[model samples]
Target: MKLVKVYVTLKESVLDAQGEAIKSAIQTMGYNQISDVHMGKYFELKFENDYANLEKDVDLICDDLLANPNVETYRYEILEGE
Candidate 1:
């Protein structure tokens, strides 16, 4: 078995309202070093070792289903075998 770690985030050109809200709330609490914030999503995909094109499959899923190409971008890594 293998573990796939996927991270999805909005492109720099897009606005991050959720991240901004969180940063503002934090700053209001007196931790005022926050200059910027960005929000994102994470996914862990576990699959058996049967598939030959796991990386390709993951890329396809990220591009087609997990992320919005115009507004978001994604990157992934395969974890160490246990």
Candidate 2:
């Protein structure tokens, strides 16, 4: 089997409001050293070992469904799975 670990994040040009809020809250709690934060999404997909079009399919899935092409970008790693 194969485990696909996908990470999706906003493009650099886009503002991460949620992350900024989290950082503000953390700073209010007295952690003044906080510089910046960015929020993102992670996904795990399991595929059979025999799947021949894994990479192509993964890219299509990410581009078509997992992420917004205009504001977000994604990268994934394939790992051996039990």
Candidate 3:
């Protein structure tokens, strides 16, 4: 089996209001050391077979489901097990 880990986040130029709100709350709670918080999404996918075509399938998933190519950026890693 192959395990895929996907991470999706807004582009640097895009505004992240949710992340800002969380940072503000943290600061109010006396956490002043943190700065520039960014929000992101994580997804884990398991493939039942065809390890040889893993990269192609993962690219398709990223393009079609996991990420919005217009504004969001994403990266994925594959873990193999015996």
TM-score of each: 0.93, 0.97, 0.90
Q: What lDDT is reached at residue 38 by model 3? A: 93
lDDT tens digits, residues 10-74, model 3? 99888999999999999999999998799999999998667778889899889899899888899
Cα deviation of 55 in candidate 3 (Å)?
0.8
Top-scoring candidate (lDDT):
2
Ranking by lDDT: 2, 1, 3
Tens digit per residue, CA lDDT, model 2, 1-82: 9999999999999999999999999999999999999999999999999999999999999999999999999999999999
Q: Candidate 1: misplaced stretches above 4 Å?
A: none
Q: How much does each candidate deviate from the true structure in C-alpha RMSD?
A: 1.1, 0.6, 1.4
Report the lDDT tens digits of candidate 1 across residue range 1-82: 8899999999999999999999999999998999888999999999787868999999999999999999999999997545
Please report the TM-score between candidate 3 and the true structure.
Answer: 0.90
* Local distance difference test scores for all models: 0.93, 0.98, 0.89
On a 0 to 100 scale, what is the lDDT of residue 18 in model 2?
A: 95
